[model samples]
Target: MPEFIPLISRQTIQNRVREIGKQISRDYQGKDLILTGILKGAFMFMADLTRQIDMDHDIDFIGASSYEGTHSTGQIVFTKQPDLEYRNRDILLVEDIVDTGNTLTKIMEFIQLLNPNSVAVCTLIDKHERRKKAIPVKYACFSLEKGFIVGYGLDYDEKYRNKPEIYDLKL
Candidate 1:
């Protein structure tokens, strides 16, 4: 097992989520917006953010996978597809973190084909340093160095999902 190093504390994450919610609310004011959360990893963040939004919005979930063990498979697998018709609707794709951009890139392509009025990306953690493609992340809580992070919806080998604080896997 890899040793874990403490990263973002639970309180800090909560504060950041509040700020992100404020930003989203301001940006999408008076607009009919739909939030589509990337499942498994993004569920926690999506739930907290949606509650804090204070605006009229709908929520849905989609499941996508990339990481296997400690590395990304470089391929995305969609387990559950979004159920709503996205035509002319403003869509926000929420993720737990943006790393490598492979998963998000593929997901964005899929979303675009649905013919939404507009689509944007929002992530709780932005691993910008690790991005290979120029995937635009509209709303991000924090930018972290390339590392294995867990908690706040991120996971480690399917463990640590319930941890409130984020941690890094010591290699």
Candidate 2:
């Protein structure tokens, strides 16, 4: 088995998720909200987040990919998108991690076409050193300079996603 170095603990992640959820619930208290998750990676984060929200909101999923194995291909490919009407709904785009920001730009562009009332982003992890696009992340759990993390719904070549805590995949 490949060695894994600990990064964010499971307890830390849970605390952050609950904090962010409460903030979102307060922000969108009187609006029709839709939490649209960017799939595969964001599944675990979204599930935990929504439960702590403490408000009525809808959920949906959109799948986007740019990774081929453990590396990013620098190309955005979306495999799924939400079917609900976005014209007048408040959209919270949830993502697992933001590295180059390329995939996020594409997702924002696609969602904008539906003319949602407003759209904001919430991400579990942010890699500041790898960002190539200026995408504003409204809510985030953790930020890192550089590292390959796999766990808590994040995977390395479709493995290690089931781990409860975040870890740096030692290569």
Candidate 3:
């Protein structure tokens, strides 16, 4: 079994998420905003953030993968696409983490093809230490210099996502 060390507590995460949601609500108040979460890592964050956002918005999900275990494969493969009609609407991609920017970059390319008015990114964790591409993350709940984390929708080889708080996974 892998040892899990406490990283960010659940209460701390919730407070930051609420703050981000409030900011997003203010920035997108008079526009048609769509929160498109990058699944399955983003599901938990998206759900909580949505409730904190006090404005009318739509929710959608896009599925892609770039990791085999703790390391990124440097390739993005789509598993599902958002079915909502979002042409000309403002889109905010809710991501669990921004690491190498490989998968998110590929996802942005695909999203741009849909012809939205504008696009931005929000993430629960901003891990820029290993970034290969410079992807603009507009709203980040937290930033980590380095560490392999799992919890609050982050996973390790498809495990540890169910934990309510973030953890540093030690094998």
What would the per-residue lDDT of candidate 3 be over residues 1-171, giving only the tens digit for each residue? 789999999999999999999999999999999999998999999999999999999999999998999899887889999989879999999999999999999999999999999999999999978999999999999999999999999999889999999999999
lDDT of 1: 0.89
Which residue pairs clash within candidate 2? Answer: none
Q: Which ten residues in a row have the lowest lDDT in candidate 3?
A: 68-77
Residue-level lDDT of model 1, residues 1-171, one tens digit each, is 678789898899899999999999999998889999998999899989998897999898889999987788888899999998888899999999998999999999999999998999999898966788888999998898778888777887788888888888775
Q: In model 2, what lDDT does residue 78 have?
A: 85
Clashes in model 1: which pairs? Answer: none
User: The CA-based lDDT of model 3 is what?
Assistant: 0.95
Evaluate all candidate structures by whole-model CA lDDT and list the values in order.
Answer: 0.89, 0.93, 0.95
Give the candidate order by descending lDDT: 3, 2, 1
Using lDDT, give the best candidate's number.
3
Residue 9 C-alpha lDDT in model 1 = 89
lDDT of 2 by residue, 1-171 (tens): 788999999999999999999999999999999999998999999999999998999999999999987778988888997978899899999999988899999999999999999999999998877788999999989989998889999999889999999999987
TM-score of each model, paired residue for residue: 0.96, 0.97, 0.98
> Which of candidates 1 and 2 is the stronger one according to TM-score?
2
Residue 26 of candidate 1: its Cα lDDT? 95
Model 1 Cα displacement at 147 (Å)?
1.2
